[model samples]
Target: MSAEFDVRYTAQLARLSLTDAEAAKFQSQLSQVLVYVEKLKQVDVSGVEPTAHSSEMNNVFRADEPRDWFTSKQALSNAPRQANDLFVVTKVIE
Candidate 1:
């Protein structure tokens, strides 16, 4: 990887302002990280299954049972303002 290209491209994408010294330092560090990632790609994983999560978890579920519901008056009892039994707020957009 070209360190100079990497530094210039990253600065442009992030709209960052970096001094000459900082640019050079970042170039070297970024190159090292890319090299390490390239090395990691050489690992073999034949017959290995991919998983979204690491832990062994089954399909967790809850019972579908009816429950008591709250009325609008009870729900908005502590609200600052209400109109027609509903919470009211200031207009958000012009």
Candidate 2:
């Protein structure tokens, strides 16, 4: 299909209203992209395996370890209102 036709069709599908100048601009850009894609098709990759990423990836998380628990007084220090070592807030359920 012609690049101009493809541009107009895509714009229609996307619900975009493009002026003649904008359509022409997008047509030129789309033609360049199609040409680059065609050029890429010429490259040989018979021996290369397809990969999701270009580089090797590994998990970045640190090891989990046990730690001391905070005292109830310390935990409730920042509470706006506390009763019986527990936070008190407006009831959410009706």
Candidate 3:
């Protein structure tokens, strides 16, 4: 990538105000990172399968069962404001 393009892209993404010197430095750093990623592309993985996570996992969900729920009074007891057995919140905008 060109230095000018890299600087513009970084500034746009990060909302940064970089000087020419800082842009030059960042461009060099980004170039190095891209080179490292390119090197990774050269590794052989023809038989390897893609995995979402590194660890082996099994579904651990418990069987759904009916349970007692809190009463309305108990549920709203600690609320700052309640109306008609429901919690009330401030309006966000006019």
Among the numbered candidates, top lDDT falls to 2
lDDT per residue for candidate 2 within 18-63, as digits (tens), equals 9999998998888887777777677898898889876788667876
Worst 10 residues of 1 by lDDT: 1-10
**Model 2: per-residue Cα lDDT at residue 30:** 81
Q: How good is model 1 by TM-score?
A: 0.41
lDDT of 3 by residue, 1-94 (tens): 3323466576879878888898879878877777667776778989989898878996778879988999999999999999999999989899
Superposition error at 69 for model 3 (Å): 19
* lDDT of each residue in 1-94, candidate 1, tens digit only: 4443578678989989789999889888888887777775677878878898988998999999988898888999999999998889989998
Ranking by lDDT: 2, 1, 3
lDDT of 2 at 62: 75
Look at candidate 3 and tell me the lDDT of residue 30. Answer: 78
TM-score for each of the candidates: 0.41, 0.42, 0.42
How much is 27 displaced in model 3, in angstroms? Answer: 0.2
Prediction 1 global C-alpha lDDT: 0.83
Steric clash pairs (candidate 3): none
